[model samples]
Target: MDTTPPPSRPATLTAPRLVERLIQGQATSDGAGVRLTRLLTQDLQRRLDPFLMLDLFGTENPGDYIGGFPDHPHRGFETITYMLQGRMRHRDSAGNEGLLVPGSVQWMTAGRGVIHSEMPEQQEGAMEGFQLWLNLPGRDKMREPWYRDIATAEVPEWQGEGVTARVIAGATHGVQGAVQRDATEPLYLDLHLAPGAVFTQPLPAHHNAFVVVYRGELNVAETLVRTRRMAILANTPGSDGVLLRAGEAGARAILVAGQPLKEPIAQYGPFVMNTQQEIFDAVNDFRAGRLA
Candidate 1:
């Protein structure tokens, strides 16, 4: 595979402009019935450029999950949910309800508005998933609503050395994922590593790149980042490899990159966009039932 970095930064997004970091934080959402660990937000938000949020949820027992997120509203962003071990049931005011099991992903675009509820599917035990909120460019806000349910087989996967990589979106190893996006060409990979593994992937000069190590340690550029940690990358690139390397056994991470929209991002709760007016409009639209 051509793991070649762009010779020069893309005019659209450059190293100095695109954001990256090892952002880390625990979930603190309102009255929680779920176990949500925040990997990026606040300053990380400013650094993500075109991406907004990443939340990891996991539980081996239902009681551990206080409950599940109920009906809520959102606008001007895309919520991409990926399942890892268990299943979750989803229902939207759009009249969509279904079960998502391991390997299933739901990409929902709440452009103008959408109201939905997410609850865990009961089984013997365990439930896990991640939700990535991707910002939509200003022009697409309120454009319309759409949904895509991508199965595990649809994602691209490749392996090398002591590590394995699954591409949920974007191209890697000559294979591409079918997941769709509205802004910033993005890549999402779920990585697993055995003892002492080294991993490398090229980034478009202008795209933002970061890694969230969920289970173990990642030595990025020689900095040790442990579990539940986000590693924001430096804007500089070199042969010493401004990259990430896994440490020890059972290390795993999610690597993401995307071209920066290079636009102001105004976000409130689950809504995201470019201006305060956009946030207001999104709130009004949801309250007025436009989400239906």
Candidate 2:
């Protein structure tokens, strides 16, 4: 007697964030002539709020990255390095040292100031990774400098339908990343999707989010994002998350989101301050041996 088809399951309603813009990273030399692709930087686009720069470095030639990033000073911000392959050794004036191997990360906060160097641990083989800069709040700009070295085993992995997401700096699907800097409340994830896989994750309503594809293609917000391309997603009203699907060969990308500080930024070289005078003070302090 019950011939009626069961009511169709309600389709999961996504918040519907769109790709507002797509940017292709440009090849450039940085850190003593090390080659990399600059993506979502202050010069390339608007200040991505609290995010300053994103660099993807990859090379098989030892000559390209062997030079490495030598002693440099940073103030009023943080630097995050995520390694996919190869090894990098970090040393700072504070007497801290770390070795970042594949699938590892080094997060350093240059609140007041810090001088550090990153050198390649090996001379050959393919090396690849990303470095992101996150701004500190005005109140925290003069705080103590700190660092966190996270090994691959420490990073949590979230598993969903055809997707494996490595949480690096935020919570996703009950998995929380190892690095935690409360000032910016950032979310960094490395995601891998199987062919035809669909993935979705919730984000803070006010956080600014973007996705950078490094391998294969992905359908993000109905837009096809290919390798070496970035998709800046719209923080649309009522949007609480993002949706992405993989192409025939699947996809891999890094998703980063953060709460904006909305403070005035005065940056010069490696220093970021709230005012031009502060920047001057920073530079002067660094030169006068007051910066640490």
Candidate 3:
């Protein structure tokens, strides 16, 4: 069956996007005491400009996630949480509250600042998800904070040719995700591929793209990337996209991309700004009760 969606024809390039670097996500704890895998962070490599941190948290043990993320404050960036298995109850200082179940996404923009808490709704089972941090441009760093919650039904899915991908943002084939923001022009998708399946996606030439493999193995470019690893795509001037193929065991992964800000990044704790003084100001603001 030729069920795969017909790929859009893009301008031919001299080469294909190649793997630039490979990062292995390591286990860590954040929030109140929730254990997770920190995939990318400013401390690890600041070169990934507009994009900040990525954490994969999943476990069957209640104690691992029950502590949850206690009341915490953030500023100067956005936080995205996507659930694959369990439920999370979230409440923010902005009077925003919601329950995120499987296949749900919550995008929180802690522009000036925000205090929020995320706790598990169920005692135990399989709790799993990813939390990503995207940096705000210098101009929008101090804007008002807000949130957008996209339920499973709201996210568009592209299924064909032994592949199913939930488009969380950006366009794939002809489907677009519900979370649309012009600032970053991001693409976030959850993908599942059957054995021997191949999938390819076109991205803007200048955009930064990466794949995080959480299950099975993937042949990215020509390199074998296994579980708990992230493959960074090279920004080849001539290349227009990336390619992937599932290994024998099949594969599950997340693809995320965004236009790079290409600006000075001053980051400290939960704040990210352009300059060190700006970071200091953010800290003072949080302590002075101005960040909310």
Candidates' lDDT values, in order?
Answer: 0.74, 0.88, 0.87
* Evaluation by lDDT, superior candidate among 2 and 3: 2
Cand. 3 TM to true fold: 0.93
Q: Put down candidate 2 lDDT per residue, 1-292, tens digits, no spaces.
A: 9995442221253685788889998889988999999996777324467898899999899999999999989999999999999999999999999999999999999999999999999999989999999999999999999999999888898777778899999877767888776778899999989898887778766788899999999999799999999899888888868888999999999999988888888889899999999999998999998865
Each prediction's TM-score against the native? Answer: 0.86, 0.93, 0.93
For model 3, the run of ten residues with the poorest summed lDDT: 7-16
* Candidate 2 accuracy as lDDT: 0.88
Q: List the residue pairs that clash in candidate 3.
A: none
RMSD of 3: 2.7
- Rank by lDDT (best first): 2, 3, 1
Model 2, residue 90: displacement in angstroms? 0.5
Q: Write the per-residue lDDT of candidate 3 for residues 1-292, one digit (tens) a residue.
A: 8895473332233465899989987788987789998889666445565689999998999999999998888988999999999999999998999999999999999998999999999997999999999989889988999899998888898876788889998878788887777888989989999897887888777888889998999998798999989999888887878788899999999999898888888888888889999999988988898766
lDDT of model 1, residue 82? 91
Pairs that collide, model 2 = none
Candidate 3, 284: how far from true, in Å? 1.2
Candidate 1 ranges beyond 4 A from true positions: 1-21, 30-32, 180-182, 237-242
**Once superposed on the true structure, which residue ranges of model 3 sit more than 4 Å away at CA?**
1-14
